[model samples]
Target: MSKVVLITGGSSGIGKSVGEFLTQKDFIVYGTSRNPENYKNSKFSILQLDVKKNDTIKKAVNAIIASEGKLDVLINNAGAGITGPIEEIPESEIKANFDTNFFGPINVIKAVLPQMRKQQSGLIINITSIAGYMGLPYRGVYSASKGALELLTEAFRMELKGFNVSMTNVAPGDFATNIAAGRYHAPLIDDSPYIKPYGDTLKLMDKHVDSGSNPKLMAETIYKIINAKNPKGHYKVGEFMQKFSIVLKRILPDKIYEKLLMNHYKL
Candidate 1:
């Protein structure tokens, strides 16, 4: 039997791309979506899931286990993109952001662990973001959420080593996806202080996203990671520039790095 893989938020965007890639590669793929009816792809099973709700996550995982008897890999790809000025974002919005982007994956990971533990070997791939490393100017909450997940991935990697379960955090830079379509915009108040600066920075961010790296490349990277004998801790996907920026962040002065971000965002 082929390896069984489950991916969350697989109705569209990078999740869908990865699911299709895995399915084509002959993995028994189960992709999740809030509304499975929206997906018409017969290549892989479309399971109903809402990462925001723990009960829904439990249900999805239970169903997968019941059907497959074993799960070989889990791709925590479901996430929400929250954008706008930090000051303008409400506390509720911030909580919601973490609930979906951070704890959502947590809930799913917890659900799958028991099954993977019994199997004694499994792989968990958390789809983080480049913004996770360097906090973005306008999307502070989103950055914080992913940053938190990156740390979780690192800590879990060490903890899961005993069970032979591997954890890899994929911090992808700008990738071509329709993430903006579902992105939440913080409510800007009347006479907002961040209006002009945010407008300029967000416009630049949009341009970069529009011309970002291919999602197919991300799928390919994930495919390789899933097939490897011993996957590494973290993988950063994007162009050479994106990888270089990560390298620069390590060696460059803090002030210089901030300046680079400022120049890039024109803030």
Candidate 2:
């Protein structure tokens, strides 16, 4: 029997590409979107899901479990982004960011674990980001959210080891996607103090994204992770600098690392 797979945020970008990749490999694949109807053009079936809403998440997971008897793989690729100075960002926006990026995957994870635990076999792949390794200049909240997920994945791996479930966190840096277009940017009033800096930072962020690696590369990485008998706890995907940043962050001193990030972002 083919493995059953569920992917979140499959309407576009890495999720969509990964969903298609898994489908091509003959997995029983299902993708989720907030407005699944928008995904009508997609070849795979789309489930209406909002990671922030437990009812929607439970319903979606239940529907899959009922049909397949079990879920083999879950790709927690759903995330939201926000950019601006921490002081300037409203509490509501920051909470919204965490809700979609952190708590959202949580609901799905909690709902799916029971079924996976009973079977004593399953794989959970979380699509984190390089920023999660270190806070970015403007996208600090987004980084925090991804950082939380990465740490959560680490802890869960130890807990799930008793069962047969495995966890993998893939951190892709600046992938070419529509994410930047929709990312929440802190409002800039005329009297705002950080307007100039915010504009410059936003430009640099866009430049990195516009020139980022293709989403299909990430899809391929996910496929490799799924097929590997024993994948590592974390995998970094992106350009040389992006991948290097992770290793450098670990080895470099605090001041040097902070300076490096500032220089890179032109801060």
In model 2, which residue pairs have backbone atoms overlapping below 3 Å?
Answer: none
**Model 2, residue 145: what's the lDDT?**
97
Name the TM-score of candidate 1: 0.97
Runs of candidate 1 exceeding 4 Å displacement: 187-190
TM-score to true structure, per model? 0.97, 0.98
The top-ranked prediction according to lDDT is 2
Best by TM-score: 2
What does candidate 1's lDDT look like per residue over 42-83, in tens digits?
468899999988888999999989998999999999999988
In candidate 1, how many clashes are counted?
Answer: 0
* lDDT of each candidate versus the true structure: 0.90, 0.91
Model 2 segments more than 4 A misplaced:
none
- lDDT, model 1, position 155: 97
Candidate 2 lands at a TM-score of 0.98
Query: With candidate 1 superimposed using the best TM-score fit, by how many Å does residue 158's alpha carbon deviate from the native?
Result: 1.1
